[model samples]
Target: MQLRSALVTGAGRRIGREIAIALAQGGADVVLHAHTSSGDETRRAVQQHGRRAWVIRGDLSSRRNVQRIAREALEKTGKIDILINNAAVFFPTPISALTAQEWHTFRQTNISAPFFLSVLIGRQMYQQGQGKIIFLGDWSGRRPSRNFLPYCVSKAGVSALTQALAKAFAPHVQVNEVAPGPVLLPEDYGPEQQEELRTRTPLQRFGSPYDIARTVRFLVESGDFVTGASYVVDGGWLAQGHDGSGTSL
Candidate 1:
């Protein structure tokens, strides 16, 4: 089999890094996209797996930038067998304090950019006859969040977009989503918050970035028959339910 090629956005850190590296380990040449010029470690890690890794930096909030990154990925890798829409912006925005600017910013990065990029890549994949497109979603989309309203809504849009695209691009390209919950904590989160999240999960533990990455790999490598679906890798967070005590299984 010919080695596959993949384009993963926001692959410079955290979950994106894990997905990119996992794809490389699975014998896929990767086009790793980052917003800032800071992915040397990720690039090195991918290269260590004996796979070609190309770094492309662009702000996904802009349609032009999204197109540019997609074009460059195709140009650099010659073919894109998989596309992981892993780039996103998450911030707190209570309903009372939500601003138009915040809504636009969140939607631009989390929804619009990924939607357009998927359309563009789906077109290319349609021409090629086979491909996989995976969107990184969130558990909050299933369970709404008051503090992260914009972020949650944008992710909900992603879930809907995945199903829509799967129907639209059927028999040629597969479209699916991976929704994670508390897999990786943000830098500002304290230890108490982390423990609270783990307690809420049925597994009683937080998921690792690699947990989501491995699930993405399975979807790409073996999910050709699967589409218009979502796999929640939340350590049973959604299945357990989020009771006020943070302990419900």
Candidate 2:
């Protein structure tokens, strides 16, 4: 099936940008979402790929905003064949400093937003008879490290959400997740820390955003029998039993 259009959240930078571009290269027009950034650069990149691009801005933490995002995206693009839930927030809480507000923020952005988007958009896809929904998850959801409790839990929710949506939209829409291990480390990570992480991975290096993006494309374009699956593109970090903790860094 040739994906005609895709909606990618947090497309302003990093992994989200790469996914947007990859979809464009796959011959799909793109709807780019950014919380704060204008996403002009990503828009231009998509256009360069000869695919149409639209920018939509909204704070995913609010249900109202998420509704607006879905409404506006559909309004701008007559139909959406793909939805990539790539927007997320990560921070160190260390358990000791974990606050209700921080927890709420993580849940709202990391889990709730995606869930709402999937439901709203998935319904349309179901009516249309086919659609693809891919969530950008984290490897930490499997074995969460210390100091990032809320973020990890939220990601875990994504795993469940993927399955639930797969069942809910069964026989029509396909829902899956791409959990990245150590593609882009935090900016504060030191060189030594980076090297340690790289050495721990079986591949002995960090995976690129393209790794995740290509996997997403495969699911949308080729994985006809796939649904409720989690693709980990971590370069074997999880295989080594490494704890992806950020507090120590």
Candidate 3:
């Protein structure tokens, strides 16, 4: 089935951009959300697929801003058939350096924003009788890297949120998550670190953004019986189990 319309957070670049474009390609008009970066590139990409596109800019860190984004998207599109919670902040927070402000930042942006957006839009979808919500999670959320404690914890909240929302919106709107692993390394990651992660993957390679986008497309376009499930697109890394290398995701 072709998706009517979708709101993709952080659609300005990386995996979010790819997901937006892929949804457009699959015949879904897209609502592109961007905060720090312009959504023009993704909007253009969506338009190239001959689907309608709208750019909504706002900071996900603020609940009011998130509410505004939902309101604006619904007003513009009439209704959103798909919602992709892909916007998040990732940074290393060493044990000794961790701060309350850091935890709050991660909680607000990574979890709180998505939670608000999900319930607000999710209720609408529930009332309408059909919709799909997909959250972009991290493999580290399951097997955390000690280096990014807050990030992992917030994402783990996402996993629980998915299950709760699925039950809340049950039998009407479908809710799920897609956890990606090593698809896009942080810009600050040095060559040795990058190589360590790449070689450690069971697939012996990194995944492309499209790998994640495609899984999202499946949940929206094809997975009618699927919900409350977390699909990990990590090149079999999760399956490898602890290789005793003490490798942290």
Candidate 3 overall lDDT versus native: 0.91
- On TM-score, the stronger of 1 and 3 is 3
Q: Clashing residue pairs in candidate 1, if any? A: none
The superposed Cα distance between candidate 2 and the true structure at residue 142, in angstroms, equals 0.5
lDDT of 2 by residue, 132-202 (tens): 99999988898788878888899999999999999999999999999998889888989888888777778
Model 3 C-alpha lDDT per residue in residues 155-222, reported as the tens digit of each score: 99999999999998999999999999889988888888888888888899999999999999999988
The TM-score-based order of candidates, best leading, equals 2, 3, 1
Q: On a 0 to 100 scale, what is the lDDT of residue 182 in model 3?
A: 84
lDDT of each: 0.88, 0.91, 0.91
Candidate 2 RMSD computed on C-alpha atoms after optimal superposition onto the true structure: 1.3
Cα TM-score per model: 0.95, 0.97, 0.96
lDDT, residue 87, model 2? 96
Residue 14 local lDDT, model 2: 93
Report the number of backbone clashes for model 2: 0
